[model samples]
Target: MISIRKILCPVDLSKGSLLALKFANAISGRYRASLAIIHIMENPHLDIPGGETGAFSFGELVNLYKEERQEEIIDVLKQKGTHAVDYEIIFKEGVPYKEITDTARNIKADMIIMSSSTSEKSEKVAGATTERTVRFAPCPVLSIKTDHDQEKREKIEKIGDLMDMSPNVKRTILLPTDFSEHSELASNYAIAFAKEYKADLIVLHVIETIAEVSFMSSVDLPGYGTTSIYYDGLLKDAQARVKNICDKAIEQGIKAREYIIYGNPRREIIDIADKESVDLIIMGTHGRKGFSRFISGSVTEAIVRNAQCSVLSVKHPEHNFV
Candidate 1:
């Protein structure tokens, strides 16, 4: 079982971030976890009090901003009726991603729930922040895309308006794996969430047949006969592995199903999530960086940016809280 004792939610007081707070509030209430709301001021400039012209010292500015941010958070929580939640407000300066991740590590946060920018243009820039945080975060990062689906956002808003604290609305969760150790780490989270919400689990293994064939053709392979034969063998192995994962979920009293698709992993995963109407997608991130990541973009990041539902990006952590 996974236990979340502390949840860190980083917000910028944007519409999307505040919407994310609703999710944070719901999950914190469900897990009975202490919520820490951290806001990072990238470049803060506060006017002197009483319309004074002199510049305030950095320490003085930080203190002033801290009090202001605290009041804003408190007012937002009070208006949302989430003031009763066990929570604290944290204010920091400097880089947003660095501060957020550092705070999570400092507080030993079990999870980081935040929102991603929804606009196509802004998403590219702001998505980098989310992607970086996911790469360095000590625990799983659950990123909520506020503008992905209108109906879903409306539903979440209604829940907040009604002060409904029941957060386990996830009925179907999609878990895509490539049979790596990172995927195995993500599988643990998928199973735990399935068991927690009593939701059906769909285990997906996507075979990049085109890429495989291209790589095989480029190299001098020995035993491999034709692409068809190689693909069939790979498909059989993937099916078996997926079945094993589903079996484990079933053993834990979860309704589990397995799926094997042959196509672009990113496209297939997104299509399946939309087709299945999945509520959440939990996938593993290899934390790839620099040249390799540039050559082959991350499928997990693509899903996080484009998926119609919420995405939880899991990286193997030094400390196993889940």
Candidate 2:
């Protein structure tokens, strides 16, 4: 059984934090796991009951200093169905990403649920704060978008919510792969998740053709004569790899299929998720800032931002997320 003992949800109590809060609460309710709410204060000083620094500009801290509104934040969660008494409120100081990752590890959290920035400038992603936390978190990261306006939006809802709406329908899950070690690791999580839900899994491999690249912007490319040959060769290789993956799952009698397509990996992944009505997209969190970590294109980031389903980003095995 996939065991989840604790779920850590970091929120600023912003409108963006609600959808993530809903997911966290739903998952905790389903798994009967503990849930904790945390609001990180970037500045350590600023009238922190006793006094430490000049002033904290994070806004929530401002209220904590002047009005003592911590309980008020808890009340908001209470109104939305999560009992305030069921969770402990964590207040920490330092850089947002560092504090978040540190808290997850210190508490042995099974998963970190937070909202990603969906602004136009962000390439529809988790932004710097969410991305860095996912990069260093000790466990799997559930990065959600802060796009809910009225009620829960379908685009941000995943398996936790699905478990509430439909318990008998076989969920379709999409897992995009690049054949990298990180992607391989993600496949393991995907397999485990599929077994948990008894769902059909679709392994998708997208080939970024020269034509698709050119469509995104002005880029010079080789003629179809050369490009088409390279495309065919790449497709064959991807097909062989996907077949192996599907065969293994099918041999075990798990519903599995393979899809190979030539297009922008980012766009294709999102489109396929919507088209298939996927419950979740389990993929590798393989993005790095500049030349720091191994640089994979932000295809994973885009999928987290725009996919019409919740995403589970599995970090490298080197990271401790147990």
Candidate 3:
């Protein structure tokens, strides 16, 4: 069994963070784990001419600000009706990602929970803090998208907040792939996860109709000219690739299935996840090497922000998740 003792959640008090807090609180409650809520107290920006020379810099004011944040978190917990779970809110002054990683390592945390917040410093997809921490953090990170609107949250929340629907339940995991290095890496993790939980694995490959110009170049077809003929070939190719992946999982003693669909990657993925009621979605933040890590418009990023299940987004440069 995977042992989760302590969970560390980093928040910036945004709506995104509030939604993430709901998931963290639910998971902590289900596992009976200790939850530590930490907020990085960034030094306030002073636009004055002698701001740097002042003795009363924002660093000196962190402790006082920390107290205020603590009270704010308590009020949030109350407002959100999350009083059942025991949590301690702490604050630190430093780089957001660095502080979050250090706090997780220092406390020997089993996992880090955070939101994909939009910041001016980082691209809007995975949030700057979340992207950096996922690559370097000592533990696995659970990043929820702020794009989940109220209706979807209510629907999934009623399902017991993603993976914690029931203890040791036979889970269904969705792994969407574009056959990139990181996507392959994510598949390995998904297969292992299925084996660990005796869960069923769903291997999906989306033949994007809209993102076709870029994607179709890579996929080898019969070189057909007509649109229908071209798509038929692409669909056939995707089906084969997806089935082979499912076979790999089945060989590893896991129940597995394959689904190939042609549509918008993000939309199809979410639709299937909701249809199958999958407990988890394992995918990569960056799939193709040609794709920029900072590309906020990637399909994985879209799914991250909209999946009806918990998302485990893997970056290429990452530590092993035990």
How much lDDT does candidate 1 score? 0.81
Could you tell me the lDDT of residue 146 within candidate 2? 58
Clashes of 1: 0
Question: What are the per-residue Cα lDDT tens digits for candidate 3 across 54-74?
Answer: 655665555456666677677
Ranking by lDDT: 1, 3, 2
Candidate 3 colliding pairs? none
At residue 173, what lDDT does model 2 achieve? 77
Q: List CA RMSD, all candidates.
A: 3.4, 5.7, 6.4
Per-residue lDDT tens digits for candidate 2, residues 101-161, read: 8888888888888877565353233356776777777788887765644344654444334
Give TM-scores for every candidate, taking all chains together and pairing residue i with residue i: 0.87, 0.75, 0.63
lDDT of each: 0.81, 0.71, 0.71
Candidate 1 weakest lDDT stretch, 10 residues: 45-54
How many angstroms is residue 291 displaced in model 2 relative to the true structure, after the best TM-score fit?
Answer: 2.4
Residue lDDT tens for model 1, 92-177:
87788899999999998888998877575644555677878987888889998777557777865664443332555548899999
Residue 51's C-alpha lDDT in candidate 2? Answer: 50
